[model samples]
Target: MKKTAQIFAGIRTPFYYYDMEILENTARQVKELAEKYRIDVHYATKANEDARIVSLLSEVGFGVDCVSGDEVKLALGCGVPVSKIMFAGVGKSDEEIFEAGIAGIGAINVESVQELYIVNAIAAKYGFVANVCVRVNPNIDAHTFRYVTSGLNTNKFGVSESEFPELVEMLAQCNNVKFRGLHFHIASQIKDIAKVTKTLCGVANRAVEWFAGHGFETEIINLGGGLGVNYENPYGDTFPDFEGWFKAIDENIVRKPGMTIHVEPGRALVAQCGDLITKVLFVKETEVKSFVVVDAGMNNLVRPAFYGAFHLIENLSAEERPSLPSNRVYDVVGPVCESSDTFGKGRQLPLTVRGDLMVVHSAGAYGQAMSMRYTLRPIAQVVYSDRINEAEKETPIL
Candidate 1:
């Protein structure tokens, strides 16, 4: 990124920079591995949803995993096939369900028995059978953040084991809803393979057998994506363990004849390829600590404020001034009014100063996608690596 900093110097501050080559390579890796394991991959559109990123992944033959009607439309607009789109969300509105039924996407992951009835009713009203998958809450702990854990009984995501009988009865009665298979997503940012191979796989197998006993044959096991990326050291292994993840599923999952396995990965595919570039606006020194304030704020990248997440931060202009101390501890903060607008605390970097370029790594997944106009801040512009020179010529320096 130091080499790229030269190009960034001429552009405006607080913008998202995406490395399309890295995204392409990561997409290719996922495609090759999915093919090797004969697993269908649907890129979770909620991760980034940038037109360039989505279009590239679509061209790579990866389907889309949508959670909203707008997201489904966005994926379709990005050239993703309607047959390749899978819609999953707990609170899908009636309009959304009607749209999905009309569009005839691959499958709609139903989270509750009541939702199954609703989907069936909507499909019946539209005179088309909606392909549906029951999202089961296996109650497995993925050991991730509390907000991201979705498989627990307490969470409001999927159907619990107690609802199996009701779900089976409902599926039997719903003529307009075609039972495709099952869906299980324990949590997001799952780094442990045991969570998938041992915990999730075991529950899914039992659920499939239970459903089959009740006259529903499982066709697709959509393992919702939670594969984690290396946020601590993204530069080391930029890619997530797609190979290991697929291998584990291939070995552990008990696939029935003519049944297909599917995965919906979001962060693992796009996180490493992007960075949030911000220029230090002030270097404030207090009695006990030092702070490096940047123009970017929680509205720009909310992971730090929302999830208490970490992204590797670096001073890209450090090498230019060798006279400065190599080790300097300071709190990296944003200019937002809220006290939670901090990026990192007690971070060690080369003596940072005003005008120094700072890069936040592993932000491609949730950074720009989750950004808002909170505090009335203008949304940051995106600059792709392949078009850096063009962006530099177009964007005037602040």
Candidate 2:
């Protein structure tokens, strides 16, 4: 913390600080664990998509999982091979489909029947066989937040059982489409490993059997990544339990011969490696409560305002003092006009004053990726540890 504070002193506030060491370590662990089981791992691009991070993951031998056309192209720009990229999104545009077909991406996870037809048409136009995996709605309740759950029957993600038969029939008639396998993504931030693994195993096994009965062989079974991380205690559990996570899948999922397993991990891989550093602008004390207003707002990091998520708040300037030595409760907020732009309701911290730097922990995943120019605020700049340290040692912070 002291080293980071010195390295970033006088540079700028409201910026993202990425510890490259943590990110590389996380990637290494995920890769090592996935390789142990021969499981194919794809770094979900939606997680960070920072060119540097994507290039690092590409170098680490991890494929990328892109959601939209822009992300697909972004991954390509990051030098991820077309064969190492899998595009998955429910509402892909015609241009996106055409581009994916032209690029010959690894697999497009077809979410709906209409998308299937559209993809097939685009592939036919391009004279290329589109490799696609049918995203199945397993109806498994990941028991995660309602907003993030995608595998529920009511969600608009995958095709239902009744719709699957018709989709299979349509696939049989299409000359430009090749059936690769089935895809299942319950949701994001899933904490219950047993519940998710058991449910995924049941759905995948049944789906494989049903497809075989219809004279189809699945080459890949993608268990969409929804693994959760410890946001409340990011330092204690910096990395998600990848060993236990893969163990659950390997022991539960009934694999077919020559079948490949793929998982798209987003949050679990990148969430803990980043922190949002915002400077305290004003310490307002009112009759109602004390509010610490920071220059950063929801436009900078919206997880708190958008999802009511909790990120550990630390006053790096007060690291020398005992934890919350003052024992005073304060509402840490941002400059955004929205009432929901509150980071923590009643955060207990040490005596804080103007210009004190605060680090919002566990922000690497959705932090900058979801940032917007709302309220006409310029988005925060990102400062990487590896680069900033070297430069800071030679000169002053910029």
Q: Whole-model Cα lDDT per candidate? A: 0.90, 0.88
Which lDDT tens digits does candidate 1 get at residues 190-233? Answer: 87955455678888989999999999999999888999888999
Compute the lDDT for candidate 2. 0.88
Using TM-score as the measure, the top candidate is 1
Question: Can you write out model 2's per-residue Cα lDDT over 1-398, one digit (the tens) per residue?
Answer: 33345556776678888888999999998899999988899999898979999999999998989999999999999999899899998899999999987898999999999999999999998899999999999988998989899999999998988887898888888889888999888899999976688778888989989988886789989998988999989988989988877888898788889999998999898999899988899999999999999988999899998899999998887775555566779999999899999988899988988878899999999999999999899888888887874332213343
Q: Which ten residues in a row have the lowest lDDT in candidate 2?
A: 389-398
Which pairs clash inside model 1?
Answer: none
On lDDT, the leading prediction is 1
